[model samples]
Target: MSAATPCVLVIDDEAQIRKFLDIGLRAEGYEVLLAADGAQGLALAATRSPDLVILDIGLPDREGHDVLSELRQWSHVPVVMLSVRDAESEKVKALDAGANDYVTKPFGIQELMARLRALLRSRPGEPDAPQRYDDGHLMIDLARREVALDGTSLALTRKEYAVIAMLLRHAGRVVTQQQLLRDIWGATHTQDSHYLRIVIGKLRQKLGDDPATPRWLKTEPGVGYRFLTDH
Candidate 1:
């Protein structure tokens, strides 16, 4: 891999899966870090701060979801989940737990690579002063960390502001619950989807979005959530 190659951490208990990912990612010019379980994965994450993490749902020592929760308490590094479970509910659980994206078992390498590229491209750019986006009466000033509705300013708490900022940064894309929790509350709170729900509710209220019929913040049912800019 080149010196400027992005680093990826693979946390899977299955040796075969890890090896497969290691080879595939290396071919794409990424430096890969391997961990056999969640504990080792967390330690490597803290020490190496890899650009992204590819995590398995089932680990030998700890549940992948738990690892994700712990990572969210402190890191904003992107995480893509790998799982054998194909049920939508399971996928939602992973996303709700803060995973950036997920790949089901038996996934094609091409699709996985594409998702990785899309996610990396979707990551927030370097921090800058909050800037404003306006579509008629809806306005958001990121630098000031403020939002306004039809010329009226809306009050928002720290967590609320963080969630909105995240949505704005990734506008038009889904912001996984895990990513939000990690970004807002840290990795340790990623698994607490209730926190995410509460903050989103407050955001919707401030934005004048009806929870019953939301126009801005849209829920993806079992998946995470998305901020609809087309509204």
Candidate 2:
């Protein structure tokens, strides 16, 4: 499939529902990924970075609301929740937990497709990250995946680059340690703050940033790290 084609991940337990969505989404020209349960769905979501997600409210392994909570910790991908229950409370819970839309089971394919189209259209044409960033001292070309200090290229390890790139993507804002760990090292490493600390230290050292008087990277003390903008 072309890179521009939107990918949709459907996490549902029922074979019929999964089949129905898989066929319907593909027919509508959307690339489709299917998961039989919450664990598998979460795994795919972490690895694949699909454009959108259709999550079932009930799963064999866990409640979909719980899955949505875990997903919100790092990703803001649009999610349209599916459920057989049409209770007002259920819709409220899903929205409160971060789902973008809710569709009760037995939904018409046309209606579901319409909702999906609207959500996809509502997304920004570009991702949150800037294509490139350059200040007098530091430069980052996210499109080219390059970083330089004072016009000299810097050699960074994969983990190091991942950390710095994530920071630059959200420049001038705090990026929680758990977010860095989960996004770069995987969800299993979210509790391992020391890993993040080591990477942060190395990043600061390479960038010639002082932790005490940070020019680029700032420590949020017991919270997370933030990449300071030149302004």
Candidate 3:
């Protein structure tokens, strides 16, 4: 497959399943790469930077959840967990670990393709992330660093707007407090959690968002925060 083609890395120890996905996904216009274990999958992910990943829960080297956890530490590439076990708890665990979606064995290729289409459609990148963010009552001109709530311009403090803009750039994913501190404040301020708390509170107030029940920014509790991407 050409380097420009949309790449999918399939990580499964089962050779037959890997072969099946190789054929099926290629037919659907995706460039396919296969890995037989979690270690190899992680290496592929780090170096290849494929657009999507299909991970199997039962791998020889590392359990799928552990791989997903490690992957989340460095990459936000969309991952779909494939497993023969159809347990609801397993699905929930994978989802909580940051898998974009989950699929079971004996699954129809059409259904998997449909899910992939939906996931890729929402994935953030060039041509997907708009410069301006507008959601009915709230509007953000990212380039201008301007914000308006309910048609009226909001006079946000420097830190307030910075927090909002940073959150918007990473719309769906959690931005850890350490990252926020380093990015918004300075590396020196990474230890100052209070700075982040104060800024987020003021930003919420400016956006007319209630901390108790967020309308735009949601708190992830002890980790960080993520902006609502539905808009």
lDDT of 3: 0.87
- Choose the strongest candidate by TM-score: 2
Ranking by lDDT: 2, 3, 1
TM-score of each: 0.55, 0.64, 0.55
Provide C-alpha RMSD values for all models, in order.
10.7, 7.6, 9.9
Number of clashing residue pairs in every model? Answer: 11, 0, 0
Clashing pairs in 3: none
Model 3 lDDT tens row, 114-212: 999898889876435557888779999998888998899999888888888888887776667777888888878877999999888888877778988
Model 1 residue runs over 4 Å out of place are 1-3, 126-231
Q: Residue 46's C-alpha lDDT in candidate 1? A: 65
- lDDT for residue 150 in candidate 3, whole number 0-100: 87
- Model 3: CA > 4 A from native: 1-4, 125-231
Which stretch of 10 consecutive residues in model 2 shows the poorest summed lDDT?
A: 123-132
State the lDDT of candidate 1 residue by residue for 58-125, as single tens digits: 99898899999988865678899999998999899999999999899988888998988888878776
Residue 95 error for model 3, in Å?
Answer: 0.2
